[model samples]
Target: MGRLIYDGEHRPIVLDDRTLAHLKVVVTTKLRRHEGFTMSWRHPDNQPRGRSTIWLHPSIPLKFIFDAPEPPELNQRWIQDLMDSANSSGGIALVDEVIDGPQ
Candidate 1:
């Protein structure tokens, strides 16, 4: 699993490396543009039954740590979908990457 440590929080939000990789792209783009958005996701099976959400802003400190030494190839379609969501009123909803989209 990968870890996303925000604002020096004691409990880092853990996610799979692949998901974290994809999310990193979106979060980076948004923060680069000084845009902030909310990202929400359902807890994994190993965790308690619940969901978590966080607001991402450029001013906030965020770190993405991966178990894998190298970053994985990113999906452009997934990134576009995430960007679209971030532009929406509801903000980004962390969804599984859809491989059906064009390569």
Candidate 2:
């Protein structure tokens, strides 16, 4: 698991390591360009039902923490999909990880 600490919140949002890694790339890229957007994700099984969305901005304090010592390999297709979502008028919506293999 990985943790995304936002705005100095006491509790961090937990995400699977792979998902967090991809999110880190998208989030950082947007923030670096001083672009702000909304990010939405469904709650995990242990958490409440429904979904959550947050407005991410360059000024906010955000941190990405990975359980593994090293970062996971990224999927370019997935990154492009995520960037598409981020650029959409509806904002960024988290999608399932895209595995590289015959379907």
TM-score of each: 0.90, 0.94
- TM-score between candidate 1 and the true structure: 0.90
Record all residue pairs in model 1 with backbone atoms less than 3 Å apart, i.e. clashing.
none
Indicate which candidate wins on lDDT. 2
Cα lDDT for residue 93, candidate 1? 88
lDDT of 2 by residue, 20-83 (tens): 9998899999999999999998888998898988999999999999999988889999998999
Report how far residue 66 has shifted in candidate 2, in Å: 0.4
Q: For model 1, how does the per-residue alpha-carbon lDDT over 21-72 read when each residue is reduced to its tens digit?
A: 9889889988999998898888889889999888889999999999999888
Q: By summed lDDT, which 10 consecutive residues of candidate 1 come out lowest?
A: 94-103
| Residue pairs clashing, model 2 | none
Among all windows of ten consecutive residues in candidate 2, which has the lowest summed lDDT?
Answer: 94-103
Q: Model 2 has how many clashing residue pairs? A: 0
